[model samples]
Target: MDPATLIGIALAFIIVVVVNVMEGGNPMAMILIPPMLLVFGGTLVICLAGGTMGDAKLAMQGMVKAFTSPAPSAAQLVPELVTLADKARREGLLALEDYVADLDDPFLVKALTMAIDGTDPEELRDILEAEVHAKKAETKQAAKFWTAAGGYAPTIGIVGTVMGLIHVLEQLAQPEKLGHLIAGAFVATLWGVLSANALFLPLGARITRLGELEVAQMELVIEGVGALQAGSNPRLVAQRLRSLLPASQREEEAA
Candidate 1:
């Protein structure tokens, strides 16, 4: 995890615990079974009911993958692609045919191979860009599921709070303790809101942004190689590819 994300999570938990201690209650109260069940169960029901089962399942898998495993960074890819571009320029585009096996990423290899096939520059751009958009849409579909789940979680939390309130109200003998019950019950809503904003929503956005950034870099490689294949000056091709970077990343050697 990024340091920023890690710090944010740590601070949120710290703040919650501090507040709970200030309330003269156990700091770990939220970890209690009733509150957890209310939050997760309610969110699950809302997601499963409001979204396709496939989307819900996909969203769960996405969240798991985001926490457990992250894909390689865009900067990590720059060297690999630069080598591919130099090789293509040196041996002719056709010569890249043999190196495709060394390339592991299906998307990158496909884009490079298409450029090597002497695909028209405009057509190559269109085809690769189209496929990128298609894959992006699919990837965003995974994020959208979490976004939709995030949207639904709060409402279900409110539902759970009301249910808790109803249950508490029915206990006539324990009326004096209703305040603590209600307070604890509302923790469900707190969990829902926090999970939505801090967890699912940000994670979904991060994955979407990362996917788009990587795709943009891949598109740059495709365009650069296309120009190289057409015998564009190396300086001109470098200039064109450099345009793909922001002013900051342009400082890289490839720029």
Candidate 2:
């Protein structure tokens, strides 16, 4: 599980609840069913109308990924690529074939398989780059769905607030109920802004960041495979892959 994503959401809710308690406000004031339906249900409508049903489904999946998907690290990959390069250089391209079946990452396996099969380097690069681009595009579109939801939620909440006020106005003659009615009406606005900032927006950003990290890892794999296929020195392959890591991480790894 992603601790950052989990802790961020938990912290947001905890802060709101604690502040409400300190202010002598009802702890349950934020839980009105009508406002929730208006904000969340209306967000669904907006999301569906803006994109295809497939995109909506992918966006939901992306949210789950944002919280649970473990990102691939270049640091871990560098050693694997270096070892493959050494084996290929010591024996031959055919020697790498045996190791392919033992690999867990399908992407790396496919790249190595193509190299062993005598695929042209240019053709290989094209295929891998296209696949990477398409995958990133799909992930990006999924993130955009959440971004649209965040943008629409606040407006939908305001709409609900207006609707509630219209109902409150009808009870104007009953002055004793006016204050309670107005406070209840504002709950819709609260639901909209809170959900937008705390949930939808953060989820979108997380998905996007995850997508970028995935693409970066794939790109590193492509370069590593290219080096191995070219029969480059193992240290050269390791150096090229290490460039993908941050300066601080590079230093630590070297140490």
Each prediction's TM-score versus the true structure: 0.82, 0.96
**TM accuracy, model 2:** 0.96
Lowest-sum lDDT 10-residue window in model 2: 69-78
RMSD of 1: 3.0
Candidate 1, residue 236: the lDDT equals 67
lDDT of 1 by residue, 1-255 (tens): 444445566677788788879989786667757766777676767767776877777777766656655443444455565566677667777888888888777777777777777677888778877887876776777788777767877776787778788878887588788887887778778887877787667768766765676676667667666665676656666666666766656665344
**Candidate 1 ranges with C-alpha deviation above 4 Å:** 1-7, 22-24, 68-83, 118-120, 252-255
What does candidate 2's lDDT look like per residue over 27-115, in tens digits? 79778999899999999888999989999999989988988887655566778889999999999989988899998878889999999
lDDT measured at residue 127 in model 1 versus the true structure, 0 to 100 = 82
TM-score of 1: 0.82
Assess candidate 1 and give its lDDT: 0.70
Report the C-alpha displacement of residue 149, candidate 1, in angstroms: 2.0
Cα lDDT for residue 45, candidate 2: 87
Measured by lDDT, the strongest candidate is 2
Residue pairs with clashing backbones, model 2: none
